[model samples]
Target: MALKAAAALDVELMSTGAFSIDQLMELAGLSVSQAVYRVHPPSAGRRILVACGPGNNGGDGLVAARHLSQYGYEPTVYYPKHNKNELYQRLSKQLEDLNVPFVNDFSKALADTDHVVDAVFGFSFSGEIREPFPAVIKALEETEIPVTSVDAPSSWSIEGGPPMSGVGSNFHPAVLVSLTAPKPLVKHFKGRHFIGGRFVAPSIAAKYDFEVPRYEGVDQVVEVMPGGKALVR
Candidate 1:
């Protein structure tokens, strides 16, 4: 359902010349990084481990790693699978130019990091948890470190968590920034929930019956859920 709506929006936005997918991805990732900064402020020793997948979500992680480095946080990327897609290849090069290390060992990244950014999955993910992803997602869950998921938690259902396959392991995020609008899965999230992607036009919001939270002027992110009930302000 989320993917269908997203596809529709993409067609409308791109065909009407509002924006391209690349542009949207960049904006979304930038907002994700900004939310990460708000939740885990940059400090000398605070390092972030950004776990990325093979899809556009990984592109977002790479983008986040770049911005996090700019914000003074040491960020290492852990992208195990690589797609031949030119978009991802370009993003990888951008991260390389920024000198952000890509760790082959997930455990090593986890050991050296202070926080986790689970960009391993987005709203489009379905099916049973796969091999490497399951292992990696397990690591993210089993750890005591705080995690900040982009869009949605890895292995989570679009409408609810635990996945429709029943692989939920109490994956909790310290912060989540739902691009465009909060997904239904966010109802299960008990941490800080934010709405990003300031470019989402109000008309789209109305069409979707989306009561997108209003951020103070010029703000890129707005907290809609501090804990339980959604807040407008």
Candidate 2:
């Protein structure tokens, strides 16, 4: 999806009054956590690091980390700049209640964790890599550990995909779980991909002229083939 279209769709969905930010975040985060579990199960390694920013994307990370813990994974959150929004506070509190640890050492996290969840940025992000994140993205680019990014890869443009060179250039996420629908930047990604956000109404999809993946049963997401087909089995 184009950047504008994606933003507009979010607005339209909220206007319908059938959904709230909390509901959407929970579903999207669950889908993200499910994707992580599917690709890198707890049997592989239980210590997962979730890197969260200060936006809605970070909220998704918080929610995903919570679900990961419920699924029996030892998940840690790396939240540098926290969002003060009530929704985000509640999400963080849920993790605290679960006894999940929050860390500030990105270097130690990179060395200690098995997998990383890149929820530091979303489709709305633009411009050069900012403070705190430069070190985070740099560490990620240099790490051998696999990553599962939620929505958009951190520091990537919604239209241009990953940067050609510099901080985010060499950082390739092993898995990407796009919410609502795959954005235009996905065309440049060559990895395991999945689409979450099953809340898109049929009329909204038709109005936007995009196809929603046929989610099986009560599944929250479906794998998207490189050719853009949903692997619905």
Which has the greatest TM-score?
2
Tell me the tens digit of each residue's lDDT in model 2 across 1-233: 89899998888888873778888889889999999988999999999999999998999999999999999999999999989888998999999999999998988888899999999999999877788999999887788899999988898889999888888988788899999989998988898999996888889988888898888887888998988898757
lDDT score for residue 220 of model 1: 80
For model 2, what is the error of residue 87's alpha carbon versus the real structure, in angstroms, after optimal superposition? 1.0
Candidate 2 — worst ten consecutive residues by lDDT sum? 11-20
Tell me, by lDDT, which candidate is best: 2
Report each candidate's C-alpha RMSD, comma-separated, in the order given: 2.3, 1.1
Q: List the residue pairs that clash in candidate 2.
A: none
Off by over 4 Å in 1: 1-3, 164-166, 226-233
* Per-residue lDDT of candidate 1, residues 91-209 (tens digit): 88888898889889998789888889999988878877676888788787788888989888988878766554444466787888888777778777888888886886778767766
What does the lDDT read for residue 75 in candidate 1?
A: 89
**How well does candidate 1 match the true structure in TM-score terms?**
0.91
